[model samples]
Target chain A: MREVVVPLAQRSYTIAIGEGLLDRRDLLAPIVAGRQVAIVSNVTVAPLYAARLRAALEPDADCVIEVALPDGEAHKHWGTLNAIFDALLEHRFDRSAILVALGGGVVGDMTGFAAAVYQRGIDFIQVPTTLLAQVDSSVGGKTGINHPLGKNMIGAFHQPRLVLADVGCLATLPERELSAGLAEVIKHGAIADAAYLDAVERALPALLARDPGALADTVARSCEIKAGVVGSDERESGLRAILNFGHTFGHAIEAGLGYGEWLHGEAVGAGMVMAADLSRRLGLLDAAAAGRLRDAIAAAGLPVRGPAWPADRYVELMSVDKKAERGTPRFVLLEGLGRACVRRAPDDAVRETLAACAPG
Target chain B: MREVVVPLAQRSYTIAIGEGLLDRRDLLAPIVAGRQVAIVSNVTVAPLYAARLRAALEPDADCVIEVALPDGEAHKHWGTLNAIFDALLEHRFDRSAILVALGGGVVGDMTGFAAAVYQRGIDFIQVPTTLLAQVDSSVGGKTGINHPLGKNMIGAFHQPRLVLADVGCLATLPERELSAGLAEVIKHGAIADAAYLDAVERALPALLARDPGALADTVARSCEIKAGVVGSDERESGLRAILNFGHTFGHAIEAGLGYGEWLHGEAVGAGMVMAADLSRRLGLLDAAAAGRLRDAIAAAGLPVRGPAWPADRYVELMSVDKKAERGTPRFVLLEGLGRACVRRAPDDAVRETLAACAPG
Candidate 1:
């Protein structure tokens, strides 16, 4: 198993990565605090692991409330958040009580946001049932619900008490979902670790085949890079924005295409491609290097081009993204592989890249 | 003008207590960072001081979005919180933007909660226009909206960058409103300062008349006591609950009174009498001391008897209060004058207190 501490002092928590860590009583025990725990999962993940999780927590859980919300990123809304609160209030949970998030990013993010706002804030443990949440959303304290107008437009950075990411769960995720998670993994490597990028480049097929050892290492390394950045900038003030390497264009695509229709990882995958193309268009990246990024990303079976979003629609959507300032879209770009900066991608440059990135 | 710092180190901010301090450039200058500032106020407050405050902020505020919400505690809900986010997104506010809260506890609490959750978290300044908000809600970082099931049930301890308590604003306040503010002032004296309680007993009429210096000193002293407790325990983990003084029974009264029926202060005024009477019954206070507490509160023209609420309803209403645990209503009882502790009041004590406090 691999462990990463988020270093937030009192709010500091550990993210455990390995096969079958979900059943480990030691890790989940120290965090849940109470005898009663609410395992907040979604419809998709409840039947799969809820029983095993309940068994694992059965040793200590005095009373358990298993709340299974409907699965899908689209379900990460205010209504879902309210449902979690309702469950907590109905069961009479206290400050000492805890909520266990038992699914992927949507479940984790929505559950965490609910925990953040329920009774001002409460304790919650992140059990990232999907590869995407394990390596990304589950680690950071960024808990929020999405607004109708934009992606992740509402929330708070309330850190979790514990994160138990069992690699075994990834076996249940669809191939496309696995590929989607790889976008974030690839992002961590591209922005902070060239060698990891090289490793993923070499091991794309094996990693895609769901090798447990490789899976643990990739998720852990991604978390390490992210943990370091988040420890310094928990709220995404500066260095943290770099972690959103593809997110600028990614969020725009997600909003433009309509949220939940496209997976967050998929949007980020395509957003990374546009960013690479844009970096090359600005001459900040070598054509070969840019093509290598595109090649590596494409080799992993991810999108190398954004959707057929129009220049104006994409512009309008990007203008509402959290990073925008005075209608200028903020893009986190590569200074080179393993180096990044957050700045506005000039209109002319963005337009040129969009034109170049068009399907031939 | 007197200044009290909550002393939260890097997140530390000052609570400036003075008459006319809201118009003081020096006080507002250090806090106003971003050009696009949103003043989250209500309909009542906006018409009263929004323009004057706007004129003062012209030098600092680049773009001001004044959100005039429906006034009263009933409006302090997630719907109101959503409105703040809607305005921010509509204006495309960046992370650097600051939120200025210009009203009583309701507006201050809701705006602070919005700022805390808006875009993960943003800096906010509290321009508390009500006596209640100025001396109480503005000082504590307890920003949240009320739930249908509870009061201030969902929130965070996200402190403000600056708290501007303009004593001059009290000049335009209604007699009932000013009396309501005095409930919190009385609470400070009851929980932490015997001398201040004595001073409040002597100066109720002058305070009611809105004597500027007396009001300023009273506000400053109340702020100092609150800041001390909060600095030591920002989250109401312990010690800080003392700052809640009459709030245990007080909040129950407000909740039973349908939240907006009785002003928070009016409920608290009656609650203080109940708490003092409960304290005496518990043998922690003398009847003479209790009489003084009740007499001073009555002299301010505030109610000292419980509202026309059934015991069963009060029980159900207070179960949802943040201070309650496992359906046990935790009361801040007086160990002696100006000293308090959170203890589970015996059922007999609460029932008898309610029976004795009936308006009849």
Candidate 2:
């Protein structure tokens, strides 16, 4: 077992990574013991894990409540988020109640948000069951639902009490979803660590093949990298924007193709390639480095190209992204293999990159 | 002009109380300069003051957008909040956008909440038109919409950059509404300063007659008392709960009668009386003190008696209040002329107070 602490002062909590941690009553008890506990998950992940998680929580929890939302990114809106509130209110859960998020990114995001706004604010624990969530979504305190105008357009910076990343749950993740998770894992290396990127490239087969050792190592490293960035810039005022290295373009891809058509990480996977290409075109990154990043993304079985859409349409979608400031979309481009910076590229350069990356 | 600074560290803001502060460009410029400004007002208040507020903001703001929502607490739900988001997104307002809440408590709350969640969080200025908002809601960082189950069941504690409390706007306030505002003003005195409560009782006629001096004095004192409480306990962990002196029962009154049937302050007015009666029954307060508080409420033209509801129903509603812990309703009872404490009362005593205070 490996534990990484996200140092967020009073809001800090540990991310525990290992196999079969879900059944570890010893680990779950301290957080849920004698407290009203609500386990929020989606239909897909809840059926597989909710009961076991409930079994572990029922022993010490004052009472256990289960709220299973509809599955998929398309449901990540106000209407779906309200279901959690409806259940909590129906059960008459008070401020002292604790919510445990027990699914992937979609579940984690919605559950975290529900906890953030429920009775002004309350405590919540993250038990991420997907690779994408374990490394990225579960670490940062960013919790919200998507607006029709843009993805993650509404949210709060509410940190969790604890994050339990049980690797055993990853066995249930579909093949394509696992690759999508790797997009963020790959992002962790691409934005901050060159040696880690090489390690990921070499361990690609082992990670894809569900090797426990490889999966655990990458999740820990990715968490540490993200926690460090989030700790320094908790509100994303400055250094935190680097974490969105590919998100500006990735959000455009998701919105353009209509959400849920491609997984978020899948969109991010292709978005990173386009960002690197843009970096190279501006002479900030070499062709060799850009190509290397694309090869690793492709080898991980994630898309390296977006849906064929006009450059103007992609630009239009990107302009509405949360990362955009005053209608101008700011791109997060890599100056090198291990360094990322946020800035606005020339209109022509952005258009050319979009046209070249996703040829219609 | 009187300014009280809410000392909340980085989230600290000033509540500027005076007549005609709404048209003060010097005060509004620093916050709105070079930023997209969204003036969120209700249909009732917009036709009255939104144009004047917008005119003052146009010189410094990049652009000023007006969003007139349906008025009243009945509309303080997800649908109304979505309208604010819709307008902001429609105009492509970015993270740097500043939301100006130009109405009473309902507008202030929804606008503050809209600013809190829009693009995660953004800057907002409170331009409270109603005396109720100026004295209470505008000073607190609490922002959220009501859920079907409970009032303020969903929200975030996102403080504003500035709070502009224009006493001039109170001139257009209805007689009942002005009296409703006095309920909170009386609460501040009842919970924190006995002398302030005495002053309010003496000045009731002047306050009712719309005397600018008396109104300004009460507003400033109310802001100071509320600010002191909020600064110490921003998340309502301990001391802040005292500030909800009558809110537990008040919220029940609003929910029980159906929201918008009785104004929030009117319910709070009657709730305060019931709470005082409960305190007296609990042996924490004397009959004379309770009567004095009730008389002040009555003198201010606010309700001193609640609607005749079954004791069990009120008990059940209070049990779901945010202040309740572990399904037990914690009462904020007054111990003396100007003292408050939170604890669970004997069920019999609570029932007795309800019967004595509100007779069908």
Candidate 3:
């Protein structure tokens, strides 16, 4: 077991990475201060882990409620998020009561957001069950639902009391989902640690085979990098924007593809390649470095090429991204391997990159 | 113009209280940093001030979009909040884009909450047009929509960049609406300032008549008290809970009456009396003091008696309040005149107070 603490001043918390953390009653006890607990999960995850998690919480909590939302990115909107609230209010959960997010990114995001707004904010715990979530989303304080026009357009920066990333949960993840999670793991390496990137490249086979040691090492390293970044820039005011390296292009792909068509990690996977391509064209990154990123993403079995939307359509979709400031789209670009910066490329350059990177 | 600065460390902002501040482009210019602006108002307020506010912002902002939701507390829910997001996304409003809330509490709250969740938070300005909003809601960082089960069950603590409390807007307010606004004004006095309470009692006729000077003084003093509390405890972790004095009972009344039946201030007006009754029964407050508080509330033309619901129903409704902890409802009871404390009274005492305060 490896524990990394995100030092966000008073809001700091720990990310516990290990196997079979779901039954770790000692951990579940201290973090959840209240007697009432609500476990928020999606349909797919609830059937798998909700009961075990609930039973773990039962000895401490007087009451344990479960809210199972429909699974998928399409359901990450206001209506679905409200269902969590409806259940909380129905069960009369108070501000001091704890909410445990018991699924992947969708469940974590929605549950975190539901906790953020439920009675003007409550404490919540993240039990992220997916590699993508464990490595990335679960560590950051960002929690929100999607707007139809854009992905992650509605949300808040609500930190969790604890993030229990039970790598054991990943054993049940589908091949495609596992591959998608690698996108973020790869992203953490590409943006901050060359040595970590090399380690990931070398461990691809072990990662694909769900080797416990390899999975744990990868998740812990990813969380350490993320926690370091988040601790410094909790609100993404400056240094944190680097974490969104491929997210601008990734969000466009997700929104352009209508949210669920391309999974978030898949989109981010291809988006990372496009960003690297753009970085190369902008004279910020070498073609060799860009190729290495593309190779690692492809080797992880995630998409390397984004959908061939018209350049204008891509621009239109990207314009609404959260990173856009005063009509100028700011993108996280690689300056080199293990280095990232948020910058606005010339519109023509961005459009040309879209044209160049489109599936041929 | 009286300005109170809410010192929330880095998130601190100024609350400008005066007459006709909506047209003060000088004040609006420095606060609204972004060139792209979206003004969120309700139908009732849009026709009255939307165009004028837009015109004030025209010279500074390149594009100004207005999203007019249907006016009323019933509309302060997810459906209406989604419309704000729809308009923002449709217009491609970015993180740098500013949202200006141009109405009473509902519009200010919805708009502030929209800005809070819009791209994980954006800068927003509050141009509160009602006495209630100007005096209370607009100054505090409490922003959210209500859930079906409870009032303000869904929300965020997102402070505005600037609060433009135009006492002039109150001139056009209906008599009942004006009285309702005074409920919060009275609450501010009852909880923090015996001198302010005396001033409110002395100036009740002028306040009822919508005298601009009286309204300005009342609003400024109320904001001063609220700003002080909010600055110290932005997330309502401790000191800020006192600001919720009467709100637990008030939210129950509002939720019981189906939101729009009684204006928020009116419900709070009656709730304050119930709280005073509870405080008196608890021996924390004298009957004479409680009577004085009730008389002032009545003088404001606000309700002193709430609906005669069963004690169990009130208990059930109040149980879901944000103040509840471990199934025990914490009521913000008066310790003395101009002093308040949150304590869990004997459940029977609460029930008896509810029974006594109910309309016979």
Candidate 4:
């Protein structure tokens, strides 16, 4: 098992990555003991691991309630979030009750958000099943649902009590989902660690083949990099915006294509490509580094280009993005393979990137 | 002008109480200067004050948008909250935009909650137009919408950047609403200060008549008490629960009668009476002290007795309250006129209080 602690003072918790952690009752006992525990998972992931999690928690948790949310990013809305609220309310879960997120990013974001607002906040544990979640979303306290107009428009910064990332769960992840997870893993490397990017490129085949050691190593490294960024700026005031390097354009893609059409990581994958191209165009990153990032993403089986759309449509969507300040979209451009900066680009320059990367 | 500072470290803010502070753009300029401002008011209060607030903010704010929500507690649900979000997204409000809650508690709560979650938290100033909000909801960071199962079931503790409590607005407040506000005023005294309670009782007629000095005095005092409690325990972990002095039963009344039927303060008015009775029954509070508290509630022209509901109905409702722990409702009962404590009373003892206070 590998452990990474998010240093958020009182809000901090440890992320544990290993095999068969789904059945690790000893790990979950301290938080849920004598308390009613609600395991919120998506329908797809629920069947795969809910029973094992329930069996693990059933011994000490006074009551283990299972709430299977409809799976997919499209269902990440207030109505879907209400399902978790309904289950908890129906069961009379109180402020002291604990919520365990037992699935992928959608489940983790929604569950963390529900914990954020339920009775003015409560404790929650993250049992991220998808690589995207284990490496990125689950570690940071950023949790929310998407609005029709924007992705992740509604949310809160509610940290988890514990994050149990069973890398073994990746064996069952869809090939497409696995690549989506690699987008963020690649992002962690692209923004902070050049050597890790090289290691990831070398390990891509093993990672795609579900090699446990490679998966655990990358997951731990990605968490460490992300934890370092999030630890310094939990609310994305300044330095933390680097974590959204691909997210600005990626969120535009998600909103433009409609949420769930392309997984968040897929949008981010193509988004990172667009950002690198823009970075190269702006004279910050060289062409070779941009090509290297694109190759890594493409080799991971992720999209390297955005869906065909007019520059205006992408700009309109990006303008409403949470990253925008005073209606101007702030792009997280790469300064180099291991450095990122947030700044607004000229309209012609942004339009050029949109035309080249997302030709209609 | 009278000011009380809520000392919450970096989240600390000032509560300004005076005759015509609502029109004081100088106070708001510090927070809203150069930022796009959204003045969230209800229909009733919007027509009355939104324009004035917009005018006050228009001079300094880049753009002042008005979101007139439906009035009353019934509108304190997600749908109404969505209206604020819709307007924000429609106007392309960014994370840097400021939300100025310009109505009563409902507007303050929804706006504060929207600020808490809109783009994962933003700055909001509370220009509470009602006494209930000025003294209670606006001071603390507790902001949320109600779930169908319970009052304030879904919420977050997102504090405001500044609270502008203009007592002059009380002159336009209806008689019943004024009484409702007094209930919380009495509670502030009942929970923490006997001298303040005495002052409130002595000046009941002046308060009822909307005396500016009296209203400002009481509102300032109540804010001081609440700020003191919240300063110590911001999350209601321990000492803060005492602030919910009558909220356990109050939430039950509000939930039982259905929200909007009894204003939160009205229900709390009756709730305080029931809590006094429960305290007397438990021998924690003497009968004379309980009677004096009941008389004060009645003197404020607020309901001293609950609506005729079966004890079991109240019990079932209270059991689901946010204050409950593991399905057992915790009551904040008085130890005397100026002190309160949280504990669970025997079922029979609780039933006796309900029979004595809420006969059905």
Residue pairs of candidate 2 with colliding backbone atoms: none
Candidate 1 wrong stretches, greater than 4 Å? A309-316, A343-346, B308-320
Interface RMSD of structure candidate 2 (Å): 1.1
Tens digit of lDDT per residue, candidate 3, span B1-360?
988888888888888888878888898887664468999999899999988899889888868999999988878888999999999888877777899999998999999999989989999999999888888888768898877776677888888988888889988999888998888888888889989989999999999888889988888898888888887777777988888788888988988777778888888999999999999999999999999999988988889988988888899888766577756788898988889898988988998998899843
True contacts kept of 2: 0.88
The residue-by-residue lDDT of candidate 1 on B93-151, one tens digit each, is 87888999999888888999898888888899998887888788877699888766566
Alpha-carbon DockQ of candidate 1 = 0.72
lDDT, candidates in the order shown: 0.83, 0.90, 0.88, 0.91
DockQ, per model, reads 0.72, 0.80, 0.72, 0.80
The C-alpha stretches of model 4 lying farther than 4 A from their native spots are A308-317, A351-360, B308-317
**Which prediction has the highest TM-score against the true structure?**
2
Lowest lDDT 10-residue stretch of candidate 2 chain B: B319-328
* Order of models, best TM-score first: 2, 4, 1, 3
Steric overlap count per candidate: 3, 0, 0, 0
CA error at residue A13 for candidate 4, angstroms: 0.9
Q: Please give, for residues A84-170, the per-residue lDDT of candidate 1 as tens digits.
A: 878887777777778899999888888898888777788888999888998998777888788876667788888898888899999
Return the lDDT, model 3, position A149: 69
Model 4 per-residue lDDT tens digits across residues B208-254: 98999999999999999999999999887799989888888898998
